[model samples]
Target: MSTVFLALQTNEDTRPIIEAILQDNPGAVVDEQPAMVKINADGRLVVRRETIEELIGRDYDLQELQVNMITMSGNLDQTDDEITLFWKS
Candidate 1:
């Protein structure tokens, strides 16, 4: 299996997003850079809307991730509830 990764700017606003990622994908590996954070996972990674809402105590839009996301690698699948990235094996 290949590793899929996503890079996002490191900032206070992104903190909860990172937390939600960690909660949703237990296998995700985080790389904290000078001003960015990168998360890597084998095969798949998912971001759930409800989890973000819970983390920030407010509704969230998965599209908000794009505001901080610098890059990503994988096939992206999205819905009202989640955003998923995976390599088809």
Candidate 2:
């Protein structure tokens, strides 16, 4: 399996919600940075694209979910948990 890295831009206050999403997704890690969050899950790292839509349906700020810039790299090992994440504000 290869390693995947992803980054997201968001408010500091939503760290917990972001963390929860990552936690629910095993082998997934969430990193909080100033006005941004980085997520590494399995071998595919990226802000939950669908998550944004889902939240928006609930009346969340769509603009807030808009990523200034998002990057995703590597492949994932579908059968196991093999990923780590690091983030700092």
Which candidate leads in TM-score? 1
Q: Tell me the tens digit of each residue's lDDT in model 1 across 7-79.
A: 9999999999999999999999999999999999999999999999999999888888899999999999999
Q: Which ten residues in a row have the lowest lDDT in candidate 2?
A: 76-85
Off by over 4 Å in 2: 12-24, 45-51, 58-66, 75-89
Best by lDDT: 1
Residue-level lDDT tens digits of model 2 in 1-89: 45556566675435544654565566776676777777665544434434544544443433443344355455422212222232321
lDDT of each: 0.93, 0.50
Looking at candidate 1, the ten consecutive residues that score lowest on lDDT are 58-67
How many residue pairs in model 2 have overlapping backbones? 0
How does model 2 fare in lDDT?
0.50
Could you tally the backbone clashes for each prediction? 0, 0
